[model samples]
Target chain A: MPGPTALNFSEATSHDMFAQRLPQSKDDSLPQVLAAAVTHLHALIRELRPTQADWRKVIEFLTDVGHASDERRQEWVLLSDLLGASALVEEINSRRPKTATPNTVRGPFFRADVPQLPLGGNISLDGIGETLDVFGRVQDLDGDPIANAEIITWQANAQGFYENQQPDLQPEFNLRGCFRTDTDGRFHYRTIKPCGYGVPDDGPVGKLLRQAGYPLCRPAHLHFMIKAPEFETVTTHIYDGSDPHLAEDAIFAVKPELVRTFEQQGKGWLLKLTFIMVRARRGAGT
Target chain B: MPGPTALNFSEATSHDMFAQRLPQSKDDSLPQVLAAAVTHLHALIRELRPTQADWRKVIEFLTDVGHASDERRQEWVLLSDLLGASALVEEINSRRPKTATPNTVRGPFFRADVPQLPLGGNISLDGIGETLDVFGRVQDLDGDPIANAEIITWQANAQGFYENQQPDLQPEFNLRGCFRTDTDGRFHYRTIKPCGYGVPDDGPVGKLLRQAGYPLCRPAHLHFMIKAPEFETVTTHIYDGSDPHLAEDAIFAVKPELVRTFEQQGKGWLLKLTFIMVRARRGAGT
Candidate 1:
């Protein structure tokens, strides 16, 4: 077979030529995404005009990120979250009406097999930290109750470590559980107040953040993935408004609508909020 | 400590907030580069508007790329080269005058331990493939001879396998050597003609190319790193003009000025060329 045309490459022509040479993929979006990525990547290179040594450092950083990721950890996901790519992507893909709860990052500690619990059931197995009572209603945009909605929630302990991160100290699924909304669309659960936590800062992503002088702490928040048959599942977090890190969440995930103040009730804290979900369009798969 | 100001994130505000929250670093360039990266990255995400599934795929791809790289291979480098970022960076950083030889990628197979060889010494240790002679004169941009210039070279065998790739089949350092110019800036050596070779396609980079339908084969070429005191060192490749893959070099590294044809001479092939060097600026480091 004849070779491709011999075209010279300069900074001006490299990107366009690279995009032009991309073979058509069976998946249409693949090529489109690849093309966009190349365009932006080349633009970054052009903007940085990094020395060869600078480029090598980038490669080394990426390699370290890869090496730090495995079954237990996802350094790349952490990187996306830290860079605000994840939150922006979540915003773009999950654009909803004003009434619907905004989607944020699901984070990296979610477990799929948490045991189901009844109303007022406590998810905190260790019973550490100050007590917290969480009561919420699930409703559609029109204020109608959405019964039997599954609310899967998880959070870090008082010390800012997830059960998964402290397997030896915390019980399996501690501060994690699944609850079902009642006929009135009310779901109540009890747990300990979660404190602000730092992302895994020992990895390359953390190293980059430190070198950039960026904070590593995410605000105290409770993850909630609520799914009802006819409504789009919203993977989101409710931030503790009083938490000092709310304003500087390392992930840029805090939305004013998703932040709630924890009222002091008796000797414990009470958090009462409502989750508004958007109905899935007919034939739309969530 | 007081929390940073609370800022709501939307598709439009996320990028700006992320940039604003980045604390000042000790290194000025760190924040600058990061800001540029965030700007471009957010733009790419806005352009693609990839679904959550698509974003997950990207993260997975990066993870796989990282996992596929180690001491024996550099999958990230391959990814960078295939995407044309490396070549662009080379072009941007090594912008020399028109008279100087252009710099290309140094590739990953170069070694510093190859023993220096006398003029006319053969580099083909295995004694395989068609015999060929290469003679070249190293000269300054003004055509003055640059004596004692070091020319470090390496290439795959005629069968398209580097010695390191097939350690058991080919002797160590086969088709690899370092040659220095004589008092007159003349150097010559004998080696077998190199053949086109596929990059390591078994890795994630190769898998990506296969899926994208991009050719994995690089053009037949010999690697060269020419260096001399008081002159900028040039890392480049000289492509075989007749090779069909010249136009489709996997790394987009082929330059028209670097292509040469082997002339038939005494039942062997002869390649005669001149190496042009650009003098380094006073007190400048190579």
Candidate 2:
């Protein structure tokens, strides 16, 4: 709060009057709190000291981040993921035991309800690309089988764009699949290897990233937001080992432990994977 | 960073994911940083547990805040002031500020260049409301006038409208004036008692304030941004002692020492005020 003054003076004196953040104060109301926050966050961004032109570019990118959204897809999600915000959120909220599987951003390309399939069923749209087999198993934290658990999977064509984002580059429904773990808690899919690709960069998010000296490409990966009754939903990504962004994925979704190598088998490649879900306790909210 | 396997079940058994200001850490870039911030701010606002209808009202008000901006005014600024951001910025950037003449928000209603007037000349033009004669002397922090200081002032007329905001309600140049301090650091103006008033509530900022249960009115005040050769220019508001919003002028510009009372003096109420400025030194950028 500014105090009043009656100190009538004529000479001018020099003073530097800029503080970056507000001193900690008790919560007064929600709006005051949020406004202080907007100010703080804005101040932090300013400290980045982006060039004026870069600032304009960032604004343009944000405009696209919003423009890129639609009923079935949300580019802002990718924008957030690339900026690492979505992952940051997952990390901050993952207070469960360390052994529990960690969460990741639910990538921009996801649908509300994926069709469930039995074990051994193939979901490849045209079985295009070099023949590849993906086999994965689901288990409880104790390594017990989660018999018949569902495994919903989706990926971009060999070109790296999601089926929804690039319908022209790749056939609709190409490389997208859903399967269920067998009694042994194992599931498999047959499709081509997904290539690393560029995210929509013509939009606001892309513009911002480009202005910030960031890349618009993400490593080749698969999307999985797993949910089972009595267990928490897990949103995550699986990265291909050889992708260039293996080191600097725009979405920051790559983890050393999550990287998997493709194995040569006969005329095709075989990839083996596993997923561990936290089992729900009795009477826990589903 | 988000690790592989987001199925952290151990902690899930005890806590729900919707707890507090959690961070998403995979991306360290600015966009991701802001995204998490939006989530956190949004969550904090939600925790206030406002009603759905109230939320709708806020959305509408914020839209209006944006709509309120046009060729001359910036409603976002008004909202910022109401949210206390303007004052916070001044507090953070205050350079070696003296306690007597603290800093404040340069409200949403300021013009770049004001007409320069001779010392002791009255700048007020309305001549309608209570005949009040505002007499003031300007001095340096050491109590000596360096002379030729610019004192530009603008305020709402008796009807609580700046000349620029309400052309029909206020005559052109009504209650808006600029004067230079004389060799003795003396200045004066005659005008009506500007009233306290509520901010336009149909804009986005107003909606947010209403939803947060914050007041919309700012206390009665006379704005002054003073500058002189070799002196530091200071922009501030001298709030009226009797205004209802004195304790919480939307912009937090109310200073205890700055508030002054008024009393009838012959044909009008006389006000005697003083402003002390710091001398600008060599190489001191104004």
Candidate 3:
């Protein structure tokens, strides 16, 4: 059992002045997570010893982050990405086995309505970057083929802008598509190689990146959401290993296992990879 | 010299995958506080092990707080107050001599443009509640009177709303005024006895309070910002000792020294308080 604990600040009688506001009934439904958040916040305040002005600066920064977010742009996601919170959350939840494919942030740009295409179909409607063929296979952890797996993919254009970001300039669903694995569990797509680009830098998250001495660049990568009949859906990214920004992705979404090399195939690039899926628990449907 | 510290998580290679994203420039302006915040956040994530859905909930709640704020209301401040961050900040900055008045949150409702009134002026322009006379004296730590001191005050009307919150119903500047201390450091004013009232309960903060099983009521109190020549300016609040909410002020602004009793006088209540000031540092200005 946990030891007895004080309800407020550990030191100074007047400090935990807010302790009186704790719920009068022990049956209050305040989740343990919220209580933990409060405890962490108190510990932060105690450790940092912030003055009034400093506290106000933080409050204002958060408010600005909120005001900066909208349907098209998620400044909160950018803020979480910049602070490494998003990465940490992914790390905590995605503890995968060595044989299974790792999970990455789904990111804010994902859409559920990507168009379905045939095998080896081209997803780059705008055709702005060097043409490349991405061929990959889907299999279970034991190497059994997971045929008919649904594979959804999206990536930023060569210039690093998602199709939605420049709707007026790019074609609808410019670099987004969904494909099904063949009988042999193989799937392929044609698209321009994604390039490193900065996150939206016109808002408060950008201000924070500048203050933290971090550039806004996220390394080039392809986002994927894969699902099979008996496996859980997985959201992930495969990064270009050669990209310099791989070591300094603005969102910290790069994992070594997710970094793949694009082979030089004449004037274009070619990527061949495999994805391993984990079986879902009984009653869990993909 | 300090010992070496690992750049990321200690247990797994994948978890610290983002370690490479740490700033490459040694001279980066990442404040120590910001670094600490990131560390604490990582610790929280590790402890809670929240899933993607759980993380998204937090992001959505904060966004709502931002969307709720405007020129008249500050939801971020309300969040901080509810979480006790505001009280903690005030406590960290308000260490004072035993005889001096303790400090409290300025609260979001204070307006600097309050009407300046002569001694014994009536500040209750709405004339809606039981009339009361408030008398106060400003004195230094040595118990000597500080004449010509300025007292800026504001409070919720009897209906539990600030004039700015209900501009359409309450008279302009219904319960706000500024007064100058007399030769003996005394000041007096007439106003309706303030009542305990709930905080703005229609925003995300209210949602949080309800979730946490807390009522939104703050104890009855008068806000004060006192300034005297060559003395530190103190922002504080004095609570009515008889208020039932005094023991559970939502914002925790009630310091023992700031609680005063109201004496029955004729058909109204009379409150007497002593405002104590500390000598400002030689170069400090209010």
Q: Pick the candidate with the highest TM-score.
A: 1
Between candidates 1 and 3, the lDDT winner = 1
lDDT of 1 by residue, A148-246 (tens): 999999999999999878889999989999999999999999999999988888889988987887778888899999999989999999989888777
User: Number of the top candidate by DockQ?
Assistant: 1
Error of 2 at A17 (Å): 20
lDDT of 3 by residue, A71-122 (tens): 7778887778777788778777765687799777777788788889999899
Standalone chain B TM-score for every prediction: 0.92, 0.76, 0.88
DockQ, in order, for the candidates?
A: 0.54, 0.07, 0.42
Q: In model 2, what is the error at residue B176, expressed in angstroms?
A: 5.7
Writing each residue's lDDT as its tens digit, candidate 2 over A1-286 gives 3333222111120010111122224564554555544544445443443433343344344334434556555665655566454544455554455666666666777765566666666666766666778888777788887776656778777766677776666656666666666788877877777788887676666665565455567788777666666776666778777765665466555656567888888888889987778865676532
> How well is each residue in B1-286 modelled by candidate 2, as lDDT tens digits?
2343332212221122212112444455554544444444444333343333333344344334434665576775675566544554555555644643655678777876667666555556657666667888878777777577788888776667787877676667777778877778788877777777777676666665666666667788888888887776778888777765665455566657578887678766777788877766677654
Per residue, candidate 1 scores C-alpha lDDT tens digits across B1-286 of 2333456577777778877867655567887788889999999999888889889988999999989888757788889998889999898987688878989987767777888999999999989998889999999988899999999999999988888778899988899999999988999999998889998788888887767766778988889999999989989999888887777777889888788888888877899989899988897657
Question: What CAPRI-style quality would you assign to candidate 1?
Answer: medium
Residue B135 CA displacement from its true place in model 2, Å: 5.3
Task: For candidate 3, report its TM-score.
Answer: 0.88
- Docking quality (DockQ) of candidate 3: 0.42
Better of 1 and 3 by TM-score: 1
- The TM-score between candidate 2 and the true structure equals 0.58
lDDT of 3 at A240: 88
Q: How many residue pairs clash in all the candidates, one count each?
A: 0, 56, 0
